[model samples]
Target: MKQQSSRTEEPHLSNVENPSRPVNSARNDVFPSSTPDNSSGESATKSSKSLWTNLKFVRLFMAYALATFGDWFDALAIQIMVAYRWGADPLIIALIPVCMAVPGILFGSVAGALADRLHKVRIMILCDGITIALTVGILFAPSPAWLLPLLALRAMMSVFHVPAQQALTRQIVAEEQLFQASSLNGFVNQCAKIAGPLLGAVVLAFFSPQICILINASARLLSGAVLWPLRRLVEKKEALVTDEHNEENQKEPETFFKQWQQGWKYLRHTHTVRNTIVFGCLGLMSILMVEYQFTTLFREIKPGNESMLGWLGSSVGAGAVFIILLLNRLPRLGYGWGLGGGYFLIGAGIAGLGWVGPDTSTAWIIMLGLCTGLGNGLFMVTMNYLLQKETSPDYVGRVFGIQNSLYSVVLVAAPLAGGAIIRSAGPSPTFQMIGLATLAIGLTGILFQRMLWSLNRRSTSSEKVGSAQQGVS
Candidate 1:
């Protein structure tokens, strides 16, 4: 007690006045203007602000949400219109996803680079405006052929918008509040998915697909207006640009091919970045196969088919909302466990779906829905959070571009593959295969967790050591 260390005495002196030194010095040490000290207790309160409360985060989320909300309505309306009017063949059905997939393959890398280079909020705003224009074009001149191209355009816009928005979200929120921001955004998206389809169906029931297109377009305009005020909140990072001292950082005027090559190089060098892309592709392919075929599969199940299918499908969204609500209270329960286990449960649920025969009860499917929804909700939110958290903020847009591109490819392939499998092997075997695949992926993820945790811990420790050295120096 008589021989106190400097560390032990520090806390007591932290509150004391030192008139010899600058009065603001203590304040400066605690909070830097550039990066807020997220370790403080107030971090939680600051991160909880909604778009109205925090216009900066609002702009980015709104950009993303509006685009997604509008596009989903358009796509669903188009699909229903095509199915009812032309009676889409398997090949035609296959073409839809392919059109959506093209932007990812063609423009994905460039979009990422642009995201790194440009103002993210502005890019998103421009994309939204373009999307609305495209919707208008589609409304006036509706054709089966235009559907794919328009979807592709939307995909391209998405390629740019997603990464920028994600990066923006991170910049606005503190590190401690990242998980909450991610979960909240994810919950809204899932809720939108549920709401969009129901709204589209109602619109279709009353008016034409063109009118639905108009409604979607209107949503975009409103989103753009909401975003206009958010320009004030965003703090643009200067990492993308070059200075006289750092000539290597100079944005070299290059050919399109060269720029594309740069994007590839950036991705190749980033270890964890590519892992997120590849995992998303493989995992989503399996999940999308189930999503695409579930409706048709449910119709063949039994008496509770209609009610159960609706409940089950909607339950996943509901589950996501539930998970979002729980995230604040249970931060210790890691998302990795939830994601891996969720995939396994989804697999089990789908496999269970195959067991529903003509005499079986539909109540089982509702339970299955709960299982699938709970797992899916957890997986989606966690995966998204991990992807953003691990990536360098400067490279977020490019990485997201690659990720979305890969995602689109899987989404395209999954439905086509599911359709083929159903036609060739029958629905039961197809469902069984999807379930087994999901279970295997989940098990593989579980096995890899220990290694991931070790790497994360080692990295964190090294970072702390580096920080201490910097402070000492």
Candidate 2:
């Protein structure tokens, strides 16, 4: 429940009296040195301008954009190659995403631990380098069997890459700039989603899938190079070394299993993090259900016109972009309301698709796409901003890693379930069911706002008590 106004403040460290407790140990401490100096009286415009002018942040942003573009580019190329070139069956093609998701579910906690132990910049650069190599292997693959495993390996690399990249953001920007930075990052990602496929489709027309793969490889290489110079910014913390004074640290250094347990424990105890993950997972499941059925829905409305699907997808991206542009001008809605209200809109938009009949115009479908996109955009930005604001820097990677794992689990199952619903109940009823379920989850957040508010209040109160005890000591 950390609001946008609190973004300028450092993470509130737990002030538990028992130094031996996991919460008070050094492994859980926020980096005091990295906290931004928000006391300056500069104008909001000036502060934003200064953040944009920072060369380091600009380079990081470019690296993120390149990496995302490559992902989407390869995604579209692979799908086309498998379907047309390899003449793969639908079930085989479906395995692609499943393979990609498996690594996150299996290795997410381990990758997060590595991010915590190693230099995050090095982790990012190494992942990108591996991606480049994987893309090359993908280009030369003779069959779907060879290609699928390579794609999964590349996805595994990303399990390490993504958490490192997100955790690194705290080091790269000031506290006040976190929301703007997340917004801009989300904007670039959305743009890549729209542009990469269009560009890939164009490339596929004139060249081979191998050439598209090569382009993706080149993008990965460029992304790694962009991140290489960020080595200086990555904090080099000592990894779980034994401390003589602190009883918790005096014991043997925490094993990987212990660290993983700590991560789960943190997530369970942190109310804001727990709620966000639960509600976010629900929203994601509903969104993916709609997305998986999109082609089927499109065929019913406009048979044999796949190109119109692209237009509708692009409309969604446009809606996201519009929200990003007006983020600063928007009212200061708290996290619960922002997330809940956004999901409500998303549910409404998805359900609206069920109403479109044979005579429904293409324009109406595009508008519905826009509605869903806007809702998703707002929900994503707000959720990311709140997670960063609430989490201690030391634990950010692990928290994000855990969230990624849970998301992967939901993603892997959602499409299969959606397919079943579509087959059994028809697409329209399936949409209505998913949308209503999502809407109900969102409504819980809105109706229980006072409960969420109390969680935040209690968090703040505990921090104050901890600070007072330290002062007295």
Candidate 3:
């Protein structure tokens, strides 16, 4: 809704608010220095109209949406092949996620460091091209045993693809548009959740699961095609930032090993990155550990094994979509507050769920699902925006790579821990404890916000001092 600006051209460095702002310098990732919404309703409406019309952003976003859609179908297709075609037990079925997560755990940060050393647009296009071959190779996987390795290989490609995509988005979209653009992308993810599975179900009825694999392969092709133009558009931002950084240091690009090590070094110094990994990741972990308990809770309350999980899951998606829409209509909420608000809302929803009982009305339960979804939508949009805005383009790849690896770790471990706890201590206490811990993390955001404020002040002062030393002041 903040769309009323008149500029229609793709992003240029002149669009940056401060001409002398330090290139690739650390700033506030949690509390962005940008202003809040002051646009009139008419201006906001105009901005909305121009949002998707910006051709550079449109092309980049389209590539992402297609990849996401195809990825969903791939998940469905693999399950069908193993479960229905090969008669796999549930244990074998579970290995699919393990395969996907393993690549992220093993290679996520390394892939990100590699992305920074290459042209991000080329990285994306190359990865997609590889994905097409990998998806096709799945058709020939002689047995379920072979599927794991193939899937792991494909996921490794994607681990590289994600950071490149994130870096490319930053280089393509204007700074002011970062939050809105990310919000729109989040909508695409939520929509794909609803549409992808439905489309897979419909297609499977009419054709073999191989048909779905073929569609996924095609999606990867098209995603690459849409990105071809970005090779030029992204260079604009890279050239802008690299000129300053390159001039300050008169050496070849840091050796790959140094770049990789430097990424870890940056993570150590950057408290904002540390905060999210510690607090944000933990909050998400808490929910994942307790989330499946819903199925158990419902089973105890109802006579038949009929679960409201499908319906409740839909409610969560709907809630997420609703909040994303609402946020897009408003001007940028203060991003630092957005982080705090997102965590608080999510923790609140999870905590509330602990109190749900058999007597709770279906409507009330649906509302709680929506609540968590709202928090998730906000958290994701803010996290992506923060990474791009705060980190130098040189380092964002590694930052996101680090995040992906940590998230995958939680994805694999949290559920296993939850299952163990539920078997011993029971679901009720586990949910209550995890939910409360998440809520406490949310409250800690305020103190972290103040700490980040001081960090930003110190960073800004250091930049000025450095410029003076270089005779640029």
Candidate 4:
């Protein structure tokens, strides 16, 4: 007689009974009486209010926002210093980003596994401390060569910091509030993106790069201090259960390589995670292509008007901020609608750029940028929220680690590919090609929505069962 594998058996049983149990259980356990009460509309309002009112959430949110702001601020300062002060060549300047990205490709999965095994809050604080120390090193760096390695080391710290922070968000916030929390986080990031560089520019106008680096280091130090208290909160909540889970995890005695492979295995088997990752990759590639061509496109439309490019960039940021704020106010939309619709809009907007030429109005060009940005903002928030929702707590860090590696690869490749296409076929055709490709990815998501949903249902069911078995054992 042939014997069936446990993995194959688990999904079949999961599909047959309690398909929604994992999501439901997460909500019920984390937020007592979180579900709406029939008699009182005010109760739901209060529940939503509680998330903002919670001291732990407020503290973490502020720390994360400050850290992000400092990062962007420091990045611009480095570019200015490298370009003007150090007299770095274009190739040297380019290497800065490449240095940051290489670590993600090499160490992302390993860092994620470590995040899963270690205390998340401590990991975040440790990473922040390292970043602060590295930032201070930049002030003393004698040459561009020295700075590049320090920047790479700083980037490596982020490889650990990001997954740990994300995993910790799951632990601290209620499941029902995850969407809003993620949205707020995205909002803070975008705000930092817009403000940080401007502030850096202002500082550079009056001060040396070293002063800006010092300010950035102080921000990092503040971030660590703010997070220091979170350890007590997390310890109180998960000490007993997490200790048991850790002990069990250690008992199996798996190698680091094997643990890293587990994340890939989970990603390969989980349909929702796989599809979302694909969709995100495609969407990001298309956006990057359009952005890379934007300067050329602007020059074609309005010859020699360099400052207009900044306005165009601002328009995109404004659009993203607008959409994020809108999503925060409205009821949460379904993942299928948000993902599919967002991509469709992004595709249409990017394709519209193909139509712009000398005859196109400046207002029209800005509008296209706004449209693409809005779609991007929608896609980012929805995909992140869904990823958090579908991923089990144990697997969150690993899944996000995989996502980071994939995104880093895309970030490095897309620009090179886009530039090649522009050189070979001109920017207009390249835009059209990227746009159509993005649209096709979105349409595929919409067409296969049912299958993806089914896969998520089965995966969630199996996770619940596995957790139950572990509890019993």
Residue pairs in steric clash, candidate 4? Answer: none
- As for model 4, its CA RMSD to the true structure in angstroms is 8.2
Q: Could you give candidate 3's per-residue lDDT for residues 1-473 as a string of tens digits?
A: 00000111255423332324543334444333344224334323333445576776777788888998898887788889999999988787777877888898988899888877788878989999998998889978888888888898999998999888776665545565766777788888887776887799899999999999999999999999988876664353333222455356534544777767767766665555566566667777877787757776566654363546766777777877888788777744654566666777777777777777767777877887888778777777776777776666556688788888887898788878887887887766666677777777766765567564234543432243233223321
Misplaced by over 4 Å in model 3 are 1-19, 23-49, 232-249, 292-294, 303-307, 446-448, 452-458, 461-473
TM-score for candidate 4:
0.84
Local error of candidate 2 at residue 254 (angstroms) = 3.7
After TM-score superposition, what is the CA distance of residue 237 in candidate 1 from its true location, in Å?
A: 2.5
Task: Choose 1 or 2, whichever is better by TM-score.
Answer: 2
lDDT of each: 0.60, 0.69, 0.69, 0.70
Per-residue CA lDDT of candidate 2, range 340-444, in tens?
867877787788887777777778888988987787777777777667656555566777888888888987988888898899988888888888777776787
For residues 399-439, could you state the per-residue lDDT of candidate 1 as single tens digits? Answer: 66677666666766777788878898878788888888987
Candidate 2 minimal-lDDT segment of 10 residues: 1-10
Residue 349 of model 2: what lDDT?
A: 77
Task: Evaluate model 3: give its TM-score.
Answer: 0.84
